[model samples]
Structures are given as C-alpha cells and as structure tokens.
Target: MGCAISGLAAKAEFGERNTGDDAAAPAAAAYLREDQIQMIKESWKVIRDDIAKVGIIMFVRLFETHPECKDVFFLFRDVEDLERLRSSRELRAHGLRVMSFIEKSVARLDQLERLDALALELGKSHYHYNAPPKYYSVRT
Candidate 1:
C-alpha cells in the first residue's frame, strides 16, 4: 500500500519543517519546544534500551504505510514483509544507528552545534541515498 496521506494533507499536518531544499531546518536552535523536550526525554527514558527496536518499527511502519518508500532502499527493494525486513542486517544496523543519532539529538538539545553537525553529516548521508527530507516529511 502506498502512502494513505496526500501531499496536501501531509503538508497541512507537518508544516513545521520545510524539507524541499538542502538548507538547514529553520530555527534549528529553538527547534524542540519545551513540551516536546519533556516528551522526548520521558519517552527516550522508557525506550532507550530498545532504540534498535524503535528504529526497526519506524522503518517498518514507514514502508507499510508508504510502500513506495521501499524503492528508496536498494537492499529493501524486493522486500515487503515487515518481519523479514526487520531481520535484515542492513535494516537492523541502519535502524540502530539512526536511533542512536536521534538519542544524541535529544541529549544535546541544549547544544545546537553538536546537533547541527549531526544534521549536516546525516544530510550528506541522505544525499547519497537520494532521499531528500521531503520524502520523509518529518515522521518524528
């Protein structure tokens, strides 16, 4: 199944960030709101040990909800089954790494440069994958 959401609908709901370009996320310093910080810390505290699973679930749900996203991954192109997909080494490794980065993002929320550097690094990686931010539309 492809994404159930239309472009218009996604934009309406996730309009906080603009992903159409290579530029940094607007207001990067103040990106995480007070409430969001509390929520992130609270949630991460609970799921910290299972971040790998979080990553796996995130990608699995992404592909399940927007099947076309699978096309972005050469390794995952032929796989549609979530269980098998989660079991793939590449999926597991990448998922864990991403979740680790997310953990850092949350941990260094007060230190903008650390998060900025990470974003730049991730942007370079994403460019290599041919996945601009618009493709994700900020699922977080």
Candidate 2:
C-alpha cells in the first residue's frame, strides 16, 4: 500500500519488523530538528482545544478504513453504522482519553527519556488490551 500519512508509523513488511540496521537509523538527538519542534508546537497550539474532535475523526477513519480493527475494540466491534458513531457518547469519551494521551505526548516531547518511558507503558497497555501495533497503523 502507498503511504498516506507522513511521519506516522507504518507496518514494515506486513507488520513483521525488519532487521535493525544502525546505518539506516537517524541519530536520536537529531530525530526532531528544532524547526520541526517549533512547527509542531505552533500547530499544537492551534488544535489543542479541538483534540476531542480530532480524536473522534481519527478513530472513525480507522474503523472505516480497516473494519477488522473493530474486533480489537469490544465496544465498537458490533457497531454497524459508522455514521451513528459520530454521536456516540462512549466514542466521545474514548476520543477524549486518546486525545489526552496525545496532549501528554506533545507536552513531553522535550523530555525524550520521559516520553520514551511513557510510550513504553502505553505499548504495554495496548498489549493487555490485545490490540497489536498493526491495528494502530493505517493500511490499505
């Protein structure tokens, strides 16, 4: 499948990790350039308040694009009408929770070590929920 989103993670070789090659990896310190960080910060300021809406849109797109992903979300698995989900209270609540995490991630960007730990914990949480990284990524 063609890439749809820049910078967002994508499954590598059908979700199977490729062998690590240090030469292909960017230096950790240069991962996010100062100008990139500034751009992200400025963009965050514009949408921070609308994160709930953004979250809802994000998940809605996820479900629509990859119907199989619904199996990972018990509450949404049986949902038949994607349009109706737009007004679902449960969905709104979940959206808030997801967006809140994004907010925290943005806030901790400068603290890479802390952010890394936070991400590790999040992956563990996903493991407990039986949601694999493949389900979190977009596919076509």
Tell me the TM-score of each prediction against the true structure: 0.69, 0.73
lDDT of 1 at 94: 82
TM-score of 2: 0.73
Q: Write the per-residue lDDT of candidate 2 for residues 1-140, one digit (tens) a residue.
A: 11232122322312323335533432132255566657777888887878888888988998999889778888888998998888888888998898888778777767777766776687788778877666454223
Candidate 1 overall lDDT versus native: 0.70
lDDT of 1 by residue, 84-119 (tens): 998888998988998998798778766767766777
Weakest lDDT window of 10 consecutive positions for candidate 2: 1-10
Task: Name the regions of candidate 1 deviating beyond 4 angstroms.
Answer: 1-36, 132-140
Cα lDDT, model 2, residue 90? 88
| Shift of residue 1 alpha carbon in model 2, Å | 22
RMSD of 1: 7.0
- Residue pairs with colliding backbones in model 1 are none
Give the count of colliding residue pairs in each prediction: 0, 0
